[model samples]
Target: MRRLMSIVAILAVCGVIVSSVSLQHHYATSKTEYCDLGETFNCDIVNRSEYSSILGIPVALIGMLGYAAVAGLATVYRERRDTPALLLGGALAGFAFALYLTYIEGRVLGAWCILCLSSLALITSITPLSFVVWVRSRD
Candidate 1:
């Protein structure tokens, strides 16, 4: 179970990396052409919008750090089962943030960065998976 969670954490990190790339592209180009092309997943619009940068730091940077921490903690937890529920809580926390940003992108910015969407989906899935694992262990 720890191994599985660790793998999931790794995948989550990968999703975050993809999101960061898309965001960086938007920041560098400052255009919605490539990202907003599919209409379904418009990284361009989200990246150029006001919400791209939170306070002074870029949202993508935050995601990168967040995901990295998750992956690292998950790995540690995998090795040490005695550890508490920090990773579980962190996963939920990350999911909440991801959901919030995705909402802002889709509603306020009128765009849906594909990479970010994937990251959100990953977090959403992880929350449930982690919960199921935890619950099952209690039994």
Candidate 2:
């Protein structure tokens, strides 16, 4: 369990970093060369779009908080029996939101953010690993 939680914590930290970059992009007044691909793959376009926020709050900020919660649960609360369930539940919710954002990028926005894709990958891995940890804890 410690090993699994360690991995989860590491991945969550990476997610935080990715989300921080996205948040920066969300507020950036100028285009960044690194994430500025062509039209179909422009981070600036996707990050600045109307869908980038919810109820006037930046989605990237929400993502940072979510990842931080997962990391905290994996590390600070790992000793608790309920931590596994909590990790699984949080992973599922993050995964679902990531999927929704992905759909918005591909379908509605017609643009993609590399940092967003990286975040999606991180959450995707975290979800399955969290499930495995939950299953093992159940046994």
Candidate 3:
């Protein structure tokens, strides 16, 4: 359980870091610039999204902060897997947010960034792993 949680946590944190860096790259090039890398690896839509920023902060930034908090919480209860209610809650929250962002990218944005999708995958993985960890803790 510890190893699984650690792996999940690492993946999720890497997702957050990558997303944040990508957003920062977009923000830097938002004006008269597009981080284009041919087709199927577009970051242009992410840069153009109206919802990409909230109160002057990038959405990716929010994701970074959120994932960081979740990681810390997971670590706090790392030894108490039997009562991992908080960790489960964190996983649920992360998974929901990731899925929502993925939907936004596919349906609303109409462009896909590999980094964002990877983040979504990480969150998705976390949800199931956390559940399994919680169950193992009980056993």
The lDDT of each candidate is 0.71, 0.96, 0.71
Off by over 4 Å in 2: none
Clashing residue pairs in candidate 3 (N, C-alpha, C atoms within 3 angstroms): none
Name every residue pair that clashes in candidate 1.
none
- For model 2, how does the per-residue alpha-carbon lDDT over 37-108 read when each residue is reduced to its tens digit? 799899998899999999999999999999999999999999999999999999999999999999999999
> lDDT: which candidate is best?
2
What TM-score would you give candidate 2 relative to the actual structure?
A: 0.98
Residue-level error in angstroms, candidate 2, position 97: 0.2
TM-score of each: 0.80, 0.98, 0.80
Instruction: State the local distance difference test value for candidate 1.
Output: 0.71
Q: How many residue pairs clash per model?
A: 0, 0, 0
Judged by TM-score, which candidate is best?
2
Q: Candidate 1, residues 1-139: lDDT per residue as tens digits?
A: 7666766677767856776786577568455464566665677667766787889778878777777766776665555653226567777888989889977976787767877777787777767766655665566
Q: Which pairs, if any, clash in model 2?
A: none
Candidate 2, position 44, lDDT: 91
Query: What's the CA RMSD for each of the models?
Result: 2.6, 0.6, 2.9
Q: By TM-score, is 1 or 2 better?
A: 2
